[model samples]
Structures are given as C-alpha cells and as structure tokens.
Target: MFLPPLNPQLGLRRQLKTIVFRIPTRESPQKPAPPMHDPASTWNTLKDILPGTDNTVATRVSENEKRVLNVFGAPHFALLPRPEPHRSPSPYEYFCTVNESASHVEQPRLSVTKLLTDAWCELQTFYDVFAGLPSARSARLSSGTRHHENLEKQAHPRVDARRVEKQIESAAQKHAPEAVEVLFGTPMAAQLASQWSEHVTMRLVEMADTCELREIHVHGFLDLARGSLVTDAAHVRAAVLVNGVVDLVRVDASNHTQREPWLEEGLLLVDLSCAIPRAKATMTALSKDHFVHVYDVKTRQNDTIPAQRSVLDAARRQCMFYSRFLADLARDSNYAYQSWLENGRRRRVEPDAPLGTGNATELLLRHFETLALDYLRLARGTDLGFDDFDNSHTHRQKQNVDGPEHASRYTLSDFVSAAQFREMLAALYGQDSPFLELDVTPLFSAWKRPLTLRYFAARAGQTCNILEAVVPGSVGVEYHNMHTRRLLKRMHFALDGATLTAAVQHAASFWNGTRLPTATDDMKRCVYCLYKNRCPVKNRATEKVGERIYRLCESQDGACENLHGA
Candidate 1:
C-alpha cells in the first residue's frame, strides 16, 4: 500500500484539507446589512448589476455583429453540426517503432515517445526557473520607470495626429467594435489585479519556503485581498513537484534506472489528490518488493526507493498514450515549436531505437534505450492482426495463409484487441505483475468512454478533430455545450488553468502557483451572472473589495463568523 508520509500529516492528506478549506466558512446569519439606497454604491455592488439566478442571458452572436469576439462573454450556440467520432490512425501506425531487421522505413523520423519526454522535461525546467521561492534570484523584468527610459531612447516617427486618430477609430470599428464603446465609457484608470485567491494564501506561503527560484516580489498573506487570483507560493510548490517527477522519470529511463517511459510520464502528472482519496492504492500498486516507509516529518529519513519496473512501464505507456491522444493539439499549431523543443530536450545521451518492437520487457528497454535509431525503421512483424496470434512462439500448425492483403504487407489495418493485448503483455514480461491487483476498470473506462469536446481538448489535445477542419462541419449544440461545460470546470480550478495557460504561453514557465488572468471580455460579458465582479465569490473580486469586505465584517462584531477573516 502507498505509505502515508512519516508524520501522517505531511502528504496529500494535508494538501487536500487545505483545498477543502478554500470553500467559504459557513455560519447562521444573525442579521442583514441595510439595503443600500445609494445608486452609485448599488451599481458597484455585485448584487445589483445582475440577476440572482444562475440562468445566463448571453446568446451567440452573428459573424457580422459589431462586437469584439470575446470568448468569455459569448452566448452558447446550438447551431453547429455535431463532431463525428474521432478516427485516430492505429496507435501502432503513428507511434510504433520499427525493428532492427527492417530494411525500409516510411514513418516520421523522430520517436514520438522521446519527443514527449523532451517536452515534459523542458516544461519542468521552466517551472524550476520561475517557480518555487518568490524571492529566488533570476533575470528581473524592467519596471514602469525602466520601461519608459527604454522607450524614450528608441527612434521616433513623425505622424499627423488627426489622421492617426482616424485610422485608429477605423481599426477599432473593424476589430474591437464592442470594446470601443466600453473603453470610451470608462475613465482612464485600470488595476493590475492579482490572481491569487484567498483559499490558497496560507498554503502558498508554506510552499514558498521550499523553492530555489523566485519570481514574485509581493508578500503573500492568507488574509490578503484578491490574493487567490494572483500567483502564490503554493502554486510554485506544486509545479516543482509535478515537473520534478516527470524530469526524474526521464532521467531514470535515460540512465537505465527505469523503463516503461509512457507509464512513468502519465503517473507523474496525475492529480492524485483528486484521483484517489488515499496514497495507499498508488503505493501498493506501484511498489513491488520495497516496503513503503513513512518518515517522521521532523526527522529526515531517506525512505524513497529505486523506481519500480511496473510503475515505470505503466507511467511511460500512459504518458505516450496521453501524448498520442493529444496529437491533434500538436498539428499545425503554434505550440508545435515548443513541442519540438521539449521533445528534443528530453532525450537521453544514448542512440535512438526503432518503433514496433515485439512484446518483451528486455526488448522494450533495449528499444527504448536506442529509440532514435529504431523509430527510423518503422518495422511491423508478420501479423495482420493481434487476434490470430497465440501464446506459443511457434505456430501450432502451418495453415494456408493467403490473400492479397497478407501478401502485400502494405495494407495496414492492424488492430490490437483486448485478448491480444493481454496475451502479448503476458508473453513480454512473464506474469510478474508489479502493480497491486486493484481494479483498473476505471482507467480503461475513462478512455473507452466517449468524451466531451472540452474534455478531449483539455486533456488529450486542443484540436483532436482534424475532420472538423476538413469537413467544415459544426460541433452540434449539445456536444458543444457539454464540451464547454467540461472545459469550464477544468478551467475553473486554479491549478489546471494556470498550468495549461502557462504551458501554452511560455512553454518553460511551470504553472505551479501562477493564477489565471481575468476572464476575456467575452467571458466577462457572458449571459451568466456568476463569477462577475459583483458576485459573492469565495475570494473577493479586487483587492479593494476584500479590504472593504474585511472592514465591514469586522466592524459588525459577532455578526458573522468571517469577521475574524477566513
């Protein structure tokens, strides 16, 4: 069983409790504040500008509408046709490596697994550089004054103010027509809103104590206003842990300390706290012979063990599958370069191997060690389908094997069935299962089940449906809505949004403690009223809002439990 941390209070258990505490504290209301009769104050209050109900009023706009295309504030559209079932090329076809005996090759030059590993490693490095300690030393960005001096030293161009203004107005009309009105209506004032929320402040501070690099200069306090939306110490700590695991596995595999790259990669990033209630299942399943030890929190005992084979294999396979699942995200996308860089960086110093090696542990490790070379060959053994194969190495009898497809070897319709997978796996490693005999139905179930568009996009890849582009079909309203909902849920959490967005934008920046920026204008203008500036969110909208709320609650002594501050 997964050993709980030595102190029984230092691992995922403590962290989860902190997350649960992020929810607002509950108390019986003794009295209510007098309704504000002041119009200005009412408008400023979140309760006034919107409906109390959850129903959203936003509707999809026409392409010709004179408004900025803000994804945030857009209405749901049910008009698009449904996306067809995804038709992935056989997994073997895309990611399989060729054998050494092969004389010809047609697959992509690089090993897909290596590419994924490299990308994962770079992501970790980025997190390490910017995450961890808030005050860790690194390159500092120029501040408001320094930026102005640099701008002054730059070359200037003479321009007609009237003409320039006219051009700007024209551009606004063509581009951000909706924003133009909003910009004009508001005063020339803006706020650098923090992303950190109230719930994570204390945890962030605790996490910040462990990092080596630091980017934040502001102090992070649990009671600080609008702190949840801003980056904090806890975020950095989580990123380091995640990236560290991934990087470690890659290092292990490269150095011959581990195998099964895909499994290792997958497990490294799983949200264990949310996935399973306790560490027991993970530890027992992953650890073979080694006993899981919990060291005392105060006393540093070296109890961690060498990476287990089953754990490594499962991790590596899962990671590759995840990457393959997200292949749609990599194609013709801006992140392609970053993906390439990450892939290149993760590789071991050893030579590359081919894809599609037969099912054997020694062979798998050997092949993984020489991935670059093996992948160049694109070898497929003499098997049209995994179904016909038996456990014995030698065929029971010489049957008449005939048909043009069999003769050509070029007709690729090889599919791996469940039985075949089981048989092959049994053959490859000879039945010494390292994982605990826990029900893994859920693991397969999650993947086997049809997924919403957003879930597919968020977890697998942003763009899995290549057919949507080629067929020019619409994502059905129901599917789109489902996808949107799933995606929104994933995005709502601080960890997922921050990490994914940071990965997209800075490839190197680990999203550990970073907060998601404010919703886009469209989201801000959505038909739904929740999460708006005026709503009673767990964390206050702006720093001023928190400070005011704190003061107001504090003044009304004993009226609210939160008067002491949550």
Candidate 2:
C-alpha cells in the first residue's frame, strides 16, 4: 500500500497528486524524514553550482523589472490575466463601485469585439467590464502589434536625408526652419526629426497613391485629415476600434473573371481588416449593391476547436458582425453615400444598405457561398486555429496523421458511463454506413469531457459536404442541433434587429454591473483560462485537506456566481 508523503514545512498546504510512499514499520516513526533542504533553495544552489548553464531565474527577474517599468511608463495600462476571470465583491458592491468610479464620466461605448468575446465566454465579458482589469500584454499580442507597427511605419516611403536637408535649407530662406543644430547635437532631437521626416513622407506616399475617381475619395483612407471617402469621423473610429487598421480598402478591383454580374456596376470594397496573426478577416463590402464577401484567411495551426461546427459557424458570425458594423455606419444620419455624377464633385448618394432589413437574408445568403467553399478547401472539417494544414509533399493522403479529428475527441465519462458513451453511437447510428463507417460519433468518451458528433446546417437548412461549391439556389445541409440532439428550426444569419440588439444590449449590461459573467460548459476554454485562480467556477471534483478544501476551476459548479452583478 502507498501513502502520501508528509512534510512538516508544507503540512499538506500544497496539493499533492496521489504520491506513493512506503508505510512505516512498528519500530519506525510515522513521519517521513523532512526534505534534506528547501526545494527552492536547493534549486538555487544547483543553479549557482552550474553558472550560466541556466539563467531562467535571472532572466525572469530582469523581465519582471522591464515589465514593471513598462507598465508604469505607459498611460492607460492596467495589466491583468488573459480572459480576466470574475472575482469578489458582492453584486451590490460591484455595482456601487462602478458608479463610484465612473459616475462623473459617461460610460464607455461597447465594442463589437468585447461583445463577441462575451458571447464566447460570458465570464470573460463580466471581468472585462466590471473588473476594470487591464488586458494582458501577451507575447502573441505584442508580436502582432509590432508587425502592424512595422507595416504602418513602411507607409511613408524613405527619402534621401541629404535631399531633406537641402529642402530644409531652402525653406530657411522663405520660412523659419526647424531647429537644425539640435538634430546633430541631441539623440532625442535627431529621433524626432527622423519621425517628422517619416510623417512628411507618408503624406507624399498617400498623395502619390490616390484612389478617388469613381466614388471620389472612396479609394483609400490615405489622408483622413483631408477627408475620407467615408462619411464622417465616428465611422472611421468605429472601424479602427473594432477591427484595428483597415488593411486595404479600394474601389473597383479588376479581375473580371472573378467578378459577378453585380461586378459590372462597379464596387467599393472594404477588402481587408487588421492582420492579427491569429484571426485575419478579409471582408469585402459592396455598400451600394448591399453585397459583401467575407473571406476567412486562417493559416491553420492557430486555433483550438471543440466542434467543427462551433468554429465554422463562428466565422460566419464574425462576417455578419462586420456587415452589421458597416451597415450601421452606412445608415448613420451624417453618413452620405457618395456616387460619381456627370458633375465634377462626387454627389452624396442615399443609403440603401440591406444588412438587417427584409432583403438582409438574401444578401447574407450570397455571402455564404464563399464561406462554404472556404470551409471545404481551407478550414477542412473544423475551423480550429490550431488545426494543422495538409502538407502536400510530406503528409500522405488518407494519412493516419493527427488532426482536428483527434483535437475534437473529448471524453464524456464524467457525464455517461464509458461503455455507454463509446458504444452509444455504434448502437444508434451503426447501420448508417457513412456516419458509422466514418466514425462520426463518439465510440468511447474520454474522462475529461463528453465526446459527441456535431453537424452544422448551412443557411438553407440542408445537408452540406466539403466537396461541393455552394451556389445561390442550391440545396443546403440537413439541420442538426448538437445541443438539442435534434433538428434546428431557424437560421442564425440576418437575425431581426431586435434579436441582434438584445444580444448587444445583454453584453452592454455588464458595464452597469447588471449581467454577471457566466462559465461555459466548454472545458477546454476553462483549461486555458489564465484567470482560474480568482474565477468563481470550480471543477466537479473537490479535495479536502486539513481545515481547507481545495477545488479546481473546472468543476460543474452551477453556482459560479457572476461576482460583478450576480
């Protein structure tokens, strides 16, 4: 028989994982000999013994110092764990605190991303608003930010320094020249001068690459100061805030073969959004025709998916979100849709955006064709970011290599008996050749979570396959509701205004500390959550040690209180 090792220092303070030990004999003492030395001190001594062999501790200390300085130096920087989990303070306390803090100032506007994040994990949304926790500066985030910054810096073409110096001299004769002496005398001044030159060059580049002929000023946001093809400032900020930098917005893209009948009418496309290494959306919106093409440019190897439908459907939802954002802007009172007339200046056209109205369904349906093709060709079965792409040369076709099929394999032993979970599919859908032959259902669920086969119906509500290219009038995939384990009655797209508004309103309620963040049944998300320490949710299992009982965040605790407002 094995027994847990006991240490006087810890006194069972730390959790142990069924450590095995030999039972003491009658003559021996019950307590195991105390550890020879403190684990931490021993590790440090080892490190000292092997100098430079490992600098992890030193490196961590230096990184911490840098991080502290960076946090203190930056304005509006309040660092917190990723997917900030909900914490203490009763609902009354939270609401009272929010009012106490921001009472004088107007509440901040709710962002689309924030809302979507909440939809993904209600608990995360709660922490985002009520907690006032600063977003963590993750490495992925820093890398993406640097990449975008590099691109933006490249916006202004470089010019010969000597040429600029000569121009500066020429300007001195007519106008007061900027301080030239400081450029050479001070490093800060030189850096400033260099920055100013880059700014001036950016304007020159923008001027060189103008795009305002058809829908004058609609070509690009080259010079926002001079005025953009967009109607106003609010819309500009909205795009940047929600989607970051607009990658490329141009009017009338050539390549007629790729263009549809509506292409002849000429189109203004909001081609690409910000380039986050994780998820980069290529949304092409034709405002006038009310047609949009939202492309999912996933590189694979980025996301972790639970169900194939979960992520595939999420992409469509993201696209619709962009469509809605643009539609709202198009319909804004100040927003004047512009058109080129026989006259010199482009005339302001009337708003005819059909994103959420009666014809909204058709327009959204048209966009679905491209999404379906992408699902088949690009994303394969699942849209998990972490899913591996097919390497043409190295990997074999019908290969036994690991992929989403394995990633989505979850253990449902917690919910059902192992025999039932693993054998249920074989009994129910066994006779169905493809479903059974393809191993469509869980044969045996793992102990971690339930494994269930999922199928998603397209907008048309029919069975769909990856091999087919979705056409406007073609039939769709048969509807399947993974949760209900039955057929679905309605479509997710072009949801009426009230439904959409309600969702946003629900998310926005968190600001008032009215809606508490909720824990999802999605165990994988919880496993990856960085804020589990303070999270209210606990796993189903609990361990009682001494006076205190320890519990993990993964428990199926229904009482996972939304500490902000619950």
Candidate 3:
C-alpha cells in the first residue's frame, strides 16, 4: 500500500513521481526520540553531503550582493526575482516600466552567440513537440512502470562546443563571411549555417567563381548587393537576374548609398521590389482591417482564409519578431548598416539607433494594431474562410530522412486519439464545433514568420537576390514571393547548392560541346534542376533543324501545321 514520507520539507512541496511512505505503528511509540537537531542547522550540516553542491548560505549571500550592485549600478537592470513560472509583466505594463526606466540607459554587453543558442533551444523544443519527431530515447514501459527514468533519459542530448565550432567554421566557408558570426547564441544556427554553406557551395560557387565574383551583400530591408563581376556583361547580367524591377533612380552619394559598386561609371539602378529569392514561400497580403487583399500564386487558393483574431494575433507577433531580428542585422555586419543608410536616407533616420531597430518598436505596434482591428471585426461576425496550401509540409518532413524507411511516417492516425483537436479548436476559435478543422498544417502558416528551410544563393549582385528564374518568359516584375522556402527551391538548380552541387558539375560536363551548351548542361541531368522542361538548360534531344518547337507550342493557332510538318 502507498504511504506518505515523514520529511518536513517534503510536506511543504509535493514533487511529482515521488515515493510515498507512512509509519506503520504510530500508537506504539513509548518515548520520543532525543531532541532533534535544529531544522535550519541540520539542513546546513547535510548540504555538504550532496556532490557538487555549494554552501547555500554563501551562494545566497553572493546573490544578494549581486542584486544590490545591480540595483545601484542600473536600477532598470534590477528585475525582481521571478517566481517559479517566470512570467514577464503584461505588454502594457512592460512597455510602461521600460519607458519609465529609460532615463537610466545601460547598454549591457550582450553575447550574440549566447542569445542565438537560447533561441535555438526554444525553437528545437517547439519543433520537436510540433513536428512530432520521434525522440531518440523514447522507451516503452510495462503497465504500472515508473516513468522517472524514461522521462529523464528521453531528453535531447546537449550540444558540445567543439561540434558547434565545426559547424560555424563550415558555415563561414560556404554561405558568407558573416553567417558564422551572425549565428552566435543559436545552437541550431550553426547547423543551419553549415547546411546553407553546403547548398551555396554546390549551386552558386561555380557560377560565381567562373565569373570572378567574390562576395554577396544582403540588404536588411530591400534584398541584396552582389560583388565581384569580372566583366560589364557579367554585372549587367547579374543586375538583370538579381532584380525583378529596375528602380529608375540616380546613384547620388548624398541621397545615401548602401551599394558596393566596383565601377562608378554609371548610376546603379536595380529592381528591389521584384527580386525575390527562388526558395521563398508564397505570400498573401492582407489589410490592417484583416480583410483578404491578395493571394500568393504558389499557395492553394482554396485554403486561403481572411484574417481573424488568430491570424491578427499571429501577424502582430510575427511583425515584432521580424522587427527585432532586422534590428540585429544592422549590428551583424557593416554592409547592412551601410545599405540601410543608402536606401532609407530620405526617411527620418535616428542618429543613435541602429538602422534596423530604428522604428522597430513603433512599426511593431502599428502593425499589431492594424492586425488587431481586422481580427476584432472578424471575430464579431465576419463570414470568411481561408484556403491556400501546398505539399510543402510533406516535402520538408521528407528531407529529414533519405529513403523509404525515412519517408513521411506521420499519418493522421497518430493524432486522432485524445481530445487534441477539440482542445486546439476551442483555444483558437473560442468555440467547439463539428465544422472545425483539424489536420497537421504547415509549420509556418504565416508569411511574416521565418521558414525552417532557407535558400542559399550566390549572384553577381547583392547578398540575398530576389529574382525568380524558375519559369522563363516571366522575368522582371512577374516574379512572386521570395520567402525562405521559395528561395531554397530556386537555388536547387541555379545555385546548385550543397546537396545538388555534384549533379550540376556532371551536367555541365555532359553538354560541353553543344550550342547553348552551359544551359543544357546545368538544367538537364542535374539533380537540383527544378525547371528542366521548356528551359534552354535542358538538352534539345527532340529539336530538329529549322523547327520552331517552342513557338509552335506557345501559339494559339492550333500547333502551327507548317512548324510541326503535319
């Protein structure tokens, strides 16, 4: 039979999974034990018995000293000792307190790497739970089996510094010089940077290397700035390919310039708005009022829904996160800061503020208000539904493993049991209904949030180019969303990145002697080639002399009898 333990400390707090015990014969006690040692002194005496345990009294005194100093040095830094749950104040309270404490400005030196590592830990925690990935150490227990050991053992292993350093070094070699430095504090950042490096090295390395292009400049707001073109043709080609729309503007120094032009012969005018990285996911614009404004072409139209409370809440959160992240970008590199000055010279700039973070607070608040209004209206009584989808979720999950055994094993069967859907819908929609939907949606449902997959590309101009070369004849302003996912997909071919680099090299060799050979070599027989068909890169195996196959197919005059020889 289960019984309670007789420890006074245990009586105060009930720990989960703790063993319980009780005295068998309380009435039979004839005499009380000799005066027990004082509770406080006894606790102190036992402290040294625990391995690696420090003297609590000394630790507490030190902590108190630190707290006092913190208060005296910068009162704003003296946060109250948070309770167990550790929650910050409400948004209003938080902002008010921060504003009130603005008089004492103390810029504590922050370690970017430490911040990144913490963020990665949080991200992994969320992803592991959300994606339902199999834990490396989940174990089966018999009925009535204790779960303590299993639970403790199932945790993801801690990362080692050496492994992290290796990843960082790899990232520096492949993606960009700044990638390694920018990833400080994020554990997954190192892994992600390495992955980006591998991909960039495979696809963009050869093209850039052949053209004698060196570095890629990524603008914090607009897009990218490309460097190292050996010839004017290469630069023009890069400018055309990198940008979707050529913004007609003079490159005046006073107006501010964030560009790195090798030749100052002419004003550098390139498209900022249209150039989207190929691997970006589809995007849909919505009004501040939560109205459906536009749909991204790649997403399924049927799944696109109007902004509701949930949508707006998510948007506000996203905008704030992005704003903060962009703020960090300014401090990450000299180029980013320069670009901000050049592009935003006309805007009212802050002298002391980092460019990215300059209007972050206001922008975040404004965007949140706009989204909130839309959500409020939708929640009141708006009849609207959203429908935009793709098999991207499935595709991403598939990337974790290589073969049939590694395929998307997560089926609907895994989540149908329990009150999961009902609980979720209740939280999201504020009501339970038979019409409520439940399925594993993509991890990134909103455009404002960062994507798990990133597209690493290299071009003649800019660090993060936004042009879409997937479907030809739709150049310039015709390109669509250039989010992480879309940019990744685009680089698969044009960039021939880490995973597909070998395939591109082999393809380049196959079409060495043919006319328009490089195109044929790069597109056909290439694993990364997503647009082999109708692209000049694909081999002309079916083409015959004097035959206009492309024109014949594109025409509306019933496949041109003369061209087809019908």
Candidate 4:
C-alpha cells in the first residue's frame, strides 16, 4: 500500500470479501447459509438496517405502514367512501300530509302573503310554516297596525254620517211636533247633526267622483301556465288557493258619467232628483264606468323613502297580485266570480276540505249580504241610538210612548228590512257596483293603471320617496309626498305582465314541488330574517371553509388532482 496507492478501491473490496469468507455459511455447523441476494430484498433490508441514513426510504416505509393500519386497525383518518348527504322534503311535500284512511294526499293551500314571503326568503317562510315560529313583533309593526286602524276609522265617517242622517229623519217623522226642538235642543245631538251633515255632503262629493276601499279581502288560484304550456288538466289543477287582503283600491270615475244620486247617496228616502239619468246605468254594468287603481301601504322605521330595490320590487309585486285578484273578482266572465265565495265559506266551515269543492259566486253573495246589513245598520244609527223601529209610524209612536224599559227592541231583520237590505246589496254588488271591471277595458289596461305604494315612517314627520330622490328623471316615474304634507312617500309602479307572470310561475314551482326553497341572495334580508340563526345558507363563511377543507382532502387522496392542477 505504501509502495503504490494503486487500486485503493480494489484493496478495500478485497478486504471486505476476505471478512465475508470468514463468516459462517449454510453448510457450517455454527450458522445457516446466508440467503441468496435479491435486489428488492437487499434494498428493503438496508432501509430497515440504516433507518437514520436515508430519510426518503424511512418516510416511504412509514407511509406504507400507516396505509395498512388505516385499512385494518383503528386509524385516525377516514378510509371508507363518503356517503351521500341527506335531503329534506320540499315545502309542498312537507305541508301536504298523507291521509292514511284515503288513497290521496291533502293538498297544501298557499296565500299571496306566503308566496310574497317566499319571494323575499323562501327559507324563512319555510321555517315559519314548518317550525311554527311565532311572527316577530316590533314597534314598527305596531305603528303600521295603528296607521291602518286610523285609515279604517277615517273611512268609517261616511258610514257614521249616514247613520246620523237616518236618526234625524226618523226623529223628524215620529216626533214631528218636537223634531226640530229635540234635535237642536241637546248640545250632543246638535253637534252630532252638524258633523253628520258635513260628512254626508263630503261622502256625496266623494261618491260622485272617486272612492277608496280599504282592506278588501281577495282570493283566487295561481294560474301557473297562463295557457302558455300544453300540460295535463290535472297538472293545471295543481293550482293552490291564494288569498290576500288588498290595502286600498282607488276607484276613479270613467268617461261614462251617469249619476244616480239615489244610488250614490244610498239613502232610505228616494227623491225625484235621485233618479238615474241614463238607461245604461243598470245594476250590473256600473263597474265599467270606473278606472280602478290599487295601492299598498308600507311603514318603515326610518325616513328612508323608496326603500331598497328588493323592498320596492316586493311591494310592487304584492300590489300587482292584489290588483289582479280584484280585477278577476270584478269580471263577470271570470270563473273566480262564480266560485270564490262558496269556496271561502266551505274553507271556513271545513278547513281541510278538498280543493275546488265550493262555489265562489255564492260566497260573494253572502259577503254582499253582510256588507248590505252593515251599511243598513250603520245608516239606521243602530250603533248610535236608533235601536228600535217598526214598519208603521203608529207602532213606532206607541213604542216611543212606552217607557224605555217597556219599549221592544227591533231585531236586525226589523232594523233593516229584507227589501231595503237587498236594494243596498244590488246597488253595491250588481252591475252598478262601484268597483271597476277589467273585462270592459282594453287588454291589460286595468292592470296598466299606475299602482301607488305609500310608505310612512315609524316616527311621525319624517318621510321621502327614495326612488324620486335618487333618480328624479326616470321615465314613467311620478314621485309625490302629498300624503300628510310630506310625511309619506308614494312611488308609482307600472304593472308588467311579463315580469308578474314570470314571478308567479317561479313561486308556483316551489309550491308544486318542482323546486326547492331558495335562500335570499341579499345579506341585508338575512339580517332581518327570523330564521337566520338556524338557516343553512345564512352564514356562508362556515360553508366556504368546509368546502375548502373537503377539496383539500380530495386533492390529497388524488381524487381532485386535476382540479388542483387547473
């Protein structure tokens, strides 16, 4: 080695072979022969023998062990395939319970309010029905309710004035000698008389030109197809019962101006001057001479005028639905007129009755009868003081002569005679009714009438129309704060049949079990939702985090490698 460092590698290899030759072989007595060297076995043996020398080899071995343990033992990671997620039933299915006794399922009824709520947040509405969540009460809601009550009271004055007039007339006829003295002698009676006169005069004026009806209840089925699709009749009959109360219906005089003062006044006494001027002014056709405009009133907590676009859109759609239903009721040719009333009555009596079982015309007649009775009672001042009356003046005088204790009280039938009540009914609901007819107008003209939505602040004296303030120059936009001298903001919306039809079809899809309830995209709406806490879609952050984790796990398993690479 000192002579020449020649072949240093050969010298080392020779020394290693000499040491191996010294070791025992298979034929030796002390030990078995060494196993034949296999390249794979030799490499694995080296990896185990020199554990700290090669980190890559140790890691690969450790991973293989883990994979084997995961398959056989109680490992930390999941190795089995994931299961499919559980799905919930749709609203229609959830609400439509199966009747064990019968072969059919009970159909679910939908309301315009519910449909509108679904439009705003289908998830929230679903929770409301499914979970039976109590509606949240707030100061704003209370204020709105009070505002509606006030409007109703304002409308009642005309009825009250008629009642006072009837009392005055009765007093004049029964106690002719002391009629004037009795009326003017008492301060209360005199004040009531004066108020009555003023109200009657104002009512007469209002009747001649326009009338405002508040809280008109309306109901009908949602026509999902609108004759657009060729579907089965049974599919079409899937239409659900939709009902709602219209906040206001404004009836304006049409070009046909034939005034029947007697009909307009609705007075017990008919005079020569009250005669109908035109032969066309029959009981059934009066609605044709009017242009009907629908309105919806909304109250907000702040002075913000127009409200968010979502809010305005909802309000517009709600008003349009109300208008459409009302127009349908007013049309003689519409099937709803013949079926709505009976259906309502049947529903009232048998809440779980099958759909499309009752008649609407009969139900309407009942409503008219009730309305007539109410008007007659109010006009006769039964609510005020005229509680007792008779057909003959002598009988009335005899009752008056008797002490108050001995006087016989008149029944509702006696208070307002059947003939008189029927007359009023015919006047209010016959062809001569004050409501406008959609059938008489040009196509879509009735629906096209400008819809006004008025908003009032929770607190008084703060209001503005946000739409008018934001975009003053928009076309077909009329902004006004005329109500209560700027305390209200009114936005006018033009009815769009296409948009309304689309919305109806969309909403109907959910009710018909064709679609799932959709969560609102607007975060602000979620903030106000009563079901936000438990809503599946309210907190997107958690969902997003979970989705990311899922994707990462999938990529690690090589299931989503392409997705990660992309």
Question: lDDT (0-100) at residue 246 of candidate 2?
Answer: 24
- Number of the top-ranking candidate, with TM-score as the measure: 4
The superposed Cα distance between candidate 1 and the true structure at residue 56, in angstroms, equals: 49
Residue 128 C-alpha lDDT in model 3: 24
Candidate 4 lDDT tens digits, 401-505: 434522323222322333443443354446465422211112112111110000000000010000011111111222223333234566777777786676677
For every model shown, the clashing-pair count is: 67, 23, 54, 18
| Global Cα lDDT for candidate 2 | 0.29
Q: Could you tell me the lDDT of residue 199 within candidate 2?
A: 27
- Compared with the true structure, all predictions reach lDDT values of 0.23, 0.29, 0.24, 0.39
For residue 224, what is the lDDT in candidate 1? 13
Alpha-carbon runs more than 4 Å astray in model 4: 1-89, 93-108, 134-137, 158-209, 223-238, 253-258, 263-290, 333-337, 350-487, 528-530, 544-566
- Local error of candidate 1 at 194, Å? 40
Worst 10 residues of 2 by lDDT: 458-467
Model 1, position 165, has a per-residue lDDT of 40
Q: Write the per-residue lDDT of candidate 1 for residues 196-272, one digit (tens) a residue.
A: 11111111121112211111111111111112221233332122111101110100011111222223222222221
